[model samples]
Target: MQLLLAHVTGIQLSVRGVWELLRTHGWSCRQPARRAIERSEAAVAGWIKETWPSAKPLPRRSGPGSSSRTRPLSR
Candidate 1:
């Protein structure tokens, strides 16, 4: 069980040990497909836009003397 978890996380594990475990359990795991990557990216982007619609237009800062001049901060 520990070896299987390690394999899924891409951490170092004894190949023989994991192979034996899989053979005993008759199971296997494969890497995610390209379609899954695209779906996940789209889902995240949608969630961000839905959650923060006002965040699209970021606030602008005033340039020096563009408005009323303010005193510079002292060290």
Candidate 2:
């Protein structure tokens, strides 16, 4: 759950937040290092999976001077 929250939300919520949420629900906090290690491993595994050979190439941009309507917006 914490791993999902951290990955999906992209927020590095503190250990205190995790502890408080668990405590509120009458659950005990797991070791902080264990949680951190799990999260880190999950993140690395995700990255590896995402960057594997099957990954699609990013779309190429048209590059500089490719557009004709170039007047500055501020002017």
Candidate 3:
């Protein structure tokens, strides 16, 4: 963000200065969402169709199942 600001406006600002400027203008930072740039739709579809059914079932029947909360929720 700081580098982009500097490139576009030709004004280099420090990290603190940039945050302060944004805060004064009611701007807030948000995390950028991640995406798989090199993902292949065909490969993923093939894997899901071919490998998913063969995958072992989760949590064997003999194993301890799920646990309940120690305390109940309060209204």
Candidate 4:
């Protein structure tokens, strides 16, 4: 945001200056409420238990096929 301010207004501000500006506008920082009031914890846990395995990354292969090279290995 400070970078944006400097980019748009040709003014650079220290971190404290940004905080002061936010406070002047009545913006106080607090932990975001990540969970909805109507969300069910049991439902969330059940979904994770039942569905998360499919969403996880594929198991990585090793040995000859697992080389991180983009092109064919040189002869």
Please report, in order, the local distance difference test score of every candidate based on alpha carbons: 0.68, 0.70, 0.84, 0.88
Q: Mind giving the per-residue lDDT tens digits that candidate 3 earns over 15-65? A: 998999899998888765775899899999999999987895786557444
> On residues 1-75, what C-alpha lDDT tens digit does candidate 1 reach at each position?
665577788765577776776778976677645565346876788889896677678778655443435865444
Which prediction has more favorable TM-score, 3 or 4?
Answer: 4
Q: Name the runs in model 3 displaced over 4 angstroms.
A: 30-75
Candidates arranged by lDDT, highest first: 4, 3, 2, 1
- Could you tell me every candidate's TM-score relative to the true structure? 0.23, 0.28, 0.38, 0.43
After superposing candidate 1 on the true structure, give the runs of residues whose Cα lies further than 4 Å from its correct spot: 1-13, 31-45, 48-75
As a whole number from 0 to 100, the lDDT of residue 63 in candidate 4 is 48
Q: Which ten residues in a row have the lowest lDDT in candidate 4?
A: 61-70
Cα deviation of 16, candidate 4, in Å: 20
Looking at model 4, the pairs that clash are none
Minimal lDDT window, size 10, model 1: 66-75
Which sections of candidate 4 miss by over 4 Å? 1-31, 65-75
C-alpha lDDT of residue 43 in model 2 = 74
Which lDDT tens digits does candidate 4 get at residues 1-75?
899999999999999999999999988898766867999999999999999988999998664652666877553
